[model samples]
Target: MKKITIQEIAKLSGVSVSTVSRVINNSPSVSAAKRKKIQAIIDEHNYTPSVFARGMVNKQTKNIGVILPDISNPYFISLITQIQKFALDYMFSTILFNTMLAEPNNKNSKHPLTEEDYLKIILEKQVDGLLILGGEIDKEVVSKDYINALNQLNREIPVVVIGSKIPELNCLFIERNLKKGITTLVSHLTALDHKNIGFIGGEAGVKITSYRLESFKAAMASYNHSVNEDWIVLSDYYTADGYAAMTKLLENNTTLPTALVAINDNVAIGAIRAINDAKLSCPEDIAIVSCDQFMNGDYQTPRLTSMDQHNEYLGKMALLQLISAINGQVEPMIINHNPELIIRESCGSKL
Candidate 1:
């Protein structure tokens, strides 16, 4: 019933504590015979190395801190799963912090955990690196105080940003190419002779919404089509918001656009519900496409045509880049991921 320690394994294996440490750390310096003997004793005793003990010798806690906005969203959930998977493979543990206290329409609202709060915790925990996703980084303008806090944190520990960019702070960024993905979505609609394309969902001041809306405009312009400002509705990134935005658009506009582009699958699904509730058929009356793809999109009345951002790959790459930065092998830089357009029934391609 007692927990066996590495020291006990070393003594039982007839090896020094240093040899046991080397074996536990997977160092090649330990001879094969000694490794076999030590490993057998370790397995027999069910010994596990204390992260604290290893940190004392190597000056590394072998732990990573991850901060993201909301884990309930499928996009963030998938991304975090991949990140945690990669970190575990490399013998690193991840600590997650969900800062979900974002206020509606206000970018500068103080959340439950301030930047200083995160900094203090990270320092106290002595994590080797930090992975930041969403929150203030998703804002069009990051506060100077938050930037200063991140700068100080980066000085003490390596930091990487996933799916957002903070230019003022010296941090590595891994993001999908917003313009190209939106362009692809528009091109698909234009190819189907959809001239009047509308956009739905996304708050006004958020950085991602701004980037995506700009990309939508550029993509539309490329086809010599001017965007209808009336069709462009601004709302939060949720299904109910999308439904309300669509309903408002229907109420205000005498002529509806032939096609609508939702910011993401959640928005697209809600828009589809609103269209059906209005006694209009999807794809037949208004073709719909989404910027992001997830599992639920497939089972809808009409399958959603969406741009796949390869979130899992993004998560894995972010962790790998962070490890490289922690090892002093790479400089802080921006990494862009290209999204793929998936054609399906929602856009009327199959119909």
Candidate 2:
């Protein structure tokens, strides 16, 4: 829809431009009688005031800077889509920076600018706030330089991280309940009469990998099952990484885990292919469960039985948190998002 000028709106509402501006900004100086009339005209016309004009009063550009590790990853894609949708509700725009550091297929490609480099750009752009997902902040031990950069940035603008909560910086954090998802998957496999379970994918040293692995072990121990160290493989987050890891497990050991929990859907698909290439069937041979669910999970050969981290909901909550921070409604804090188990053929649940 075309946006009409504020002057046109004021003229239509039979009020001065300053009166309309005051009404748009919710200035208490405007009388209720005029405020109600102007508001009704705004509602009827669906008029959205310009951010530049609003900035003069609120000192906000109304643009949010969204920084994520990779755009190629389905998880970030799903999450960012929701962020953009909700930002518009408050007349805010999102400026996305795809760092491309975690792109599975483009590992060999080189990018000159690091995440901090993008932070400088974001500052220059003068965004109202920052929403960061899965980058240096997701490391178990984030670099001092990165932490310094983030702290400096936070001093200027509110920063929200959709990952781990760093003690060094007082940035607000929104994290997934990694233990619940992992424990729930293990419980499902155990209930299905599967005793031996293994894990695949996810590189070590990353905060997410550590969280999932810890939860996987704890979950298995909870059910009186021992974790097989040999079957547990730590690799990158990619289809090829999963294929290679699974193949290594299949080749080296005749004794295998009855069930496997993958790091993500990409790894699960690769593991399934490796299982198939070895002349084995999913569920019938080695039931698979994925930690992360993607958009195309249902279309896989055997639909993925995975943990739905509710990325969309996470994204929405992140935006809301950022909005709250922008409005000075919150301080540095953490919100834990709950993940759900989505069952499908891959886990032998359908069979």
Candidate 3:
């Protein structure tokens, strides 16, 4: 069988090439009857528009590059899953690059790529847009090299960063309100008479950790409660880190805080493990609340009370913002998403 070009498809369907293109793009301008005819022919001959072929015409690969710190994380997994699902509606595909900046457990992994290297790869592939979920962009003090690479990338294509905004870098930013989430959780615990609440997990140097920790202090002060210097434990963002941090906290402080605010669900789960190891019961002995919700927070031993980041919604919005920027909507959009606190048994709010 001979290859059918877009022209041949248009001729076969009794339409112009542009009309066929419109149908292929799911454009509403095409008449319903013409769309049906073109679609049926598309299905019958299994005629699919090639991304490269379309790119030659419109200079768009219909592809987006997503750079995140770790793929093993449940939050990133769910986020990418949602982004991939929603990208279908826009007839777009995503290419993923994990920077592994969040303490990856993969001892046998691919050659690590710097943020610049990943940016270079994305540019070489000629992706139409870019979405950065986490990594150096979330650092307490971003490096000059990382900033320069991002500056170059922004000049080349539409870029969206789903973290704190760097004023110097001109890109669309979708900032998550980690501070508000912490404030809400702290208030929740305080309302339950948890005055001596300590914070666990997340490295102290990371910008995200600072955001949550600073908010914890502010929230405590707002309620006229003093923070115990001994109860504050800073560790990396992982289960093992959380476990070790909590164990150390348990050991160093004979008198522990009545409750704890975890960096995230994964860390919260780790702290709970440590609690059990110490032969102490969660909620009964120490109430726990997670700053960010994960996939399995509900199934944990006592179930986790967490701040829902709405990853699905965030994923969708990130793609939409990128698309808008790709379409020349270059007015630097900043979206602030406040996390919602989902009450569960972990915090023992009911009790």
Please state every model's RMSD to the true fold in angstroms.
Answer: 3.2, 3.3, 3.0
- Model 3 Cα lDDT, one tens digit per residue, 276-303: 9999999999999998899878899999
How do all the candidates rank in terms of lDDT, highest first? 3, 2, 1
Q: What TM-score against the true fold does each predicted structure earn?
A: 0.86, 0.89, 0.90
lDDT at residue 322 of model 3 (Cα atoms): 92
Q: What is the Å distance of residue 281 in model 2 from its true position?
A: 0.8
Local lDDT at 178 for model 2: 81
Report the CA-based lDDT of candidate 3 relative to the real structure.
Answer: 0.88
Q: How does candidate 2 fare on TM-score?
A: 0.89
lDDT of 2 by residue, 8-90 (tens): 87898788989999888678999898899888888988887767878777788999999988798888888999899989877
Which RMSD does model 3 reach against the true structure?
3.0
Q: Which regions of candidate 2 are displaced past 4 Å?
A: 1-36, 40-48, 101-111, 332-336
Q: Given candidate 1, what's the lDDT at residue 141?
A: 79
Candidate 1 positional error at 242, Å: 0.8
What 10-residue stretch in candidate 3 is worst by lDDT? 101-110
Error of 2 at 315 (Å): 0.9
Q: Relative to the unseen true structure, what is the C-alpha lDDT of residue 50 in candidate 3, on a scale of 0 to 100?
A: 85
